[model samples]
Target: MQHILNRMIVQSMETDRSWFEGDLMERFLRYVRVHTTSDPHSASTPSTERQFDLARMLETELRSLGSTDVTLDEQCRLIARVPATGPGDPIGFMAHVDTAPDFPGEHVNPCVHERYDGGVIELGGGFTLDPAEYPMLSRYTGETVITTDGSTLLGADDKAGIAEIMTAVAYLTAHPQIHHPEIEVIFTSDEETGRGMDGFPVEKLRSGFCFTIDGTDEGAVEAECFTAYKATVSFTGYSIHPGSARGKLANATSMAATYIAMLPRSESPEATDDRYGFYCATEVTGGISKASATIILRDFDHDIVKRRISYLEQLARTIEGSFPGGKVDVNVDRQYLNMADFLAPHPEVLDRVRKAIAATGMEPVIHRIRGGTDGARLCERGIPTPNIFTGGQNLHGRYEWIALPAMVRASKTIVNLVQLFAG
Candidate 1:
């Protein structure tokens, strides 16, 4: 039945000039329903076993798409090699299968609009997707826009990316006459938790450059991202009965709250945009006896990142001093560095992205990622990967949406990027 539905969809798409558009749309809808939300606290490679669901599905799909050397490793990275028609080293395209844990990722019911009317869209749960609130939707008017039902995230953060890659792979297999070099297609897991590239085997890639299809908006190209750090502050206190509590009992929860309170509201994720960096408190948990808080510090400048780290360390000491009997510990873990330095030598990497977007008839908008992508670590590891757009909006939330036409353009951009690499 599923195969029949797939064939029907493809057959319907055959009527369209860009046959891959229907495939990209269906692929995204199917992938998001698989429940691949990742866990941040998990020590495992994928951070969640369920991510294997999409990985396994893509592995089989890639083989069926005429892709060679397809492999889904234990770490939940599904890689496939598209044999070269001409001759050159393979260039890679990547996206993540895992959805963000910030919102409900399971049982996603997407609302597909054939042609938006440029009015308010009533997503359920009293959440209305108003064009006034999101000016980006104005551009999507009169287009096929996919959105959440207001119950779960649309998961277009990277599913749209996955769909674009899959559609491009399908396009390549269908059109062998279009000259191109060898292509590597990679889909990763746990990207939402910022550990997608953990122990990434750089040796696996034969590509001199890779493009991550994980950006938002149309014609977006990103070559840089914030240097990220994971800082955990642990608070320790004495657990005592309320009858004997008084001043003798030191409250760890209070200490954690105090530390959080010390964070500047003006220097938070909600407070900043573009190249400006900030500290984000992701998680806080504990009782009076023990507790811990997880905060992510990000800056485009390494020196600023260093200063942020130092500030956090000093803040921990201050909290300890205030608690007296309570204990505070701050552990800062380097996540990924700014990819700009690593990619500085390769101007063509970004140049080709511009050319590709231009070939798709859109003006490429170059920007910096306020957050990081799997390509960030890959860039630092010598692949010199940059990111291209996936047509996503309001990512990681129930209000998330995407324009189907934009993703189709992105797929063509990938095809163009592949050909440019051959040249």
Candidate 2:
């Protein structure tokens, strides 16, 4: 029965010329221009009001495309169902609506280079994406590429994913003869701030399996990701007049600096890659009397993350003991864990993805993500979700770009996955 449904869908798609002419690039460009950068300091679900702008737009677009159950929640998460025409388990595709706050995401002007020549492409502000520096450009030599004007990030990290998912759903909706199970498309907000799934109601989704189209590179599927923790260390010191301050003053700023110095320099983010762990000091601020530092610990091994937390605690105690009149406090919070642990038991999840990528005429490139995605949190909540690529490069910065042809292939991969699952 499933095979029959798949065959009918394929035949219908082949007969419909409009299915191949969907405008994925236009959707992506429209999304990136909205300036939906998430804020880490906001105590809200979306972390930014502008995120709702994109959410509302996506909600309207999904309804126009004939999607059912299309709803945008207060948290700025937009979910809609592409109703199935045949029997199969419901599948979900997710992508975040917010871009990273590390760089500016306002007033984005995208540059379209049709049939890119393999050479140094000059973005404004003296930033050039040289093929010698980023050899990936050579691989995308003849393909159309979309980049920023060196003033703001392109937001292609997940917007490309969102566009691809939207394009695939639009195609599936137009061709009703393409029989498959229901598909839940979720556009999340604040993924860059690490709260994309914080308020998401997974039980309501009813999807047995899902995919987060939030990674970089083409043909890459990530099943494993870093176990993460965020740590805050605060220091209190005695303030005294410098003229009579001998043995009477302990500087809080100095204490914070000492704690950072104690962290392993060779094990920092700039030094580690490919399965190695890191302890990074992300922010530090305050006066001599009081200071605080924010640090993040990441590793594929849960035990290593625990060890890093213990080390921070031990360092805090040592600093307190040395400063006689000063005090130090350390707090650690678990963010997310390696999705591989949750996905390992379910081999079919990734196996199906491998087959789907191959169906797009590309070999599946299996790799572990050095960072976590919203999919990791979903997998922990009993939904087996792995990550697929969005054809983005140099994400979270002015040099970010997307290969247009690769983006098209990613959309095809989504369509193929639906058909494969139906069978």
Candidate 3:
């Protein structure tokens, strides 16, 4: 362990000299500047052509680092293998290369706050990440942080994960005598647009177990995620002139609003935590002639998730038939299921991860993910994957920032897991 740590420290020191000090921040800037945001409407494998830019760059880096079978597939997913020092089940590190479409991820100007004083750090001249406004910043006082320049998102959500993985892989490859088992490295595209693993081949991945380095804070280890379902409600109402529409007009928008009002206020993302479930009204648009609503139901409990979807469908049916001339359409789609159901059967994977985390001199916090992750999908596909932290906060917004020390810790954790699983 000490030998491995010594190698990591030396490699990290070398990385610090030429963009290594700012390597993660610089890598993050280069990636976010390429405009790799996915389009939900596009049919392409990557959903965006610009994603190929980062994909090609990563492929080059992997090859340069002596990784074998480094290839960027037609789907824009990059895969490579680092030969193990001894016989052991392959371990993998995974992250997405795409940013969310909800924000402008292109031309990102990432700014560094060196030795942050834990105050309101201005991004540009206008936007700022104030500790008072965001108390999470207080946790990283005296540590270097990376943030955006108020023009675009920093893309640290997963880019941070990418950098951490890259640095760890580079560390292991540069020092072959560190005694590690077979390691697989994967970077997927279009994670933001909900199709991250749409075409993912789980059977092809050679890892016995995996963990996503995509959580907030340094000590959080997420083993479960919400079972998510989407419910769409469409309303059809009679369109009539106001003068003669007194009893004829169904007012679909009003009915939609009524349905929204009926959803329990206490059950919302803002009102819940840990194992609590919620109904979130994501989008609503309507008129007297037609109206539609998109709602998301989330919970960790399979039964609760099922009950919420049923409640939504039943309510929509009642609302649809409420008026003689009014009609409603309801569609419920199961987006993803909780991984705990599958992971419980594979307790060894969790035990190995817990052991790896504890070896880092930090107590592991095994918490449930409030939102679904690609790991949830991977678990369902056969690999019982969990989530580790990337030390990022306020993801998907301008307030996003990452602590440099925490990022280093993440790299160390990855190395520890690889060694612990190595035979």
Highest-TM-score candidate: 2
Top-scoring candidate (lDDT): 2
The reply for model 3, stretches above 4 Å from the true place, is 1-33, 40-43, 113-122, 131-142, 236-258, 287-290
Query: lDDT tens digits, residues 359-381, model 1?
Result: 67799998887777789899878
Per-prediction TM-score? 0.83, 0.88, 0.85
Mark the 10 consecutive residues where model 1 has the least summed lDDT. Answer: 1-10
Worst 10 residues of 2 by lDDT: 1-10
Clashing pairs in 1: none
Total clashes in model 1, counting residue pairs 3 or more apart in sequence or in different chains? 0
Clashes of each: 0, 0, 3
Clashing pairs in 3: 15-20, 16-20, 16-21
| Model 1 bad stretches (over 4 Å) | 1-16, 41-43, 122-127, 233-273, 279-295, 311-330
By TM-score, the better pick of 1 and 3 is 3
Candidate 3 lDDT, 195-214, residue by residue in tens: 87887877678997878888
Each prediction's whole-model lDDT (CA): 0.86, 0.87, 0.80
Poorly placed runs, candidate 2 (over 4 Å): 1-21, 41-45, 117-132, 149-151, 238-251, 286-289
Quote model 3's TM-score.
0.85
lDDT of 2 at 220: 96
Error of 1 at 172 (Å): 1.2
Q: For residues 75-151, write the lDDT of model 2, one tens digit per residue.
A: 99889998897788999999999999999999999998888999899999998888898899899898788999999
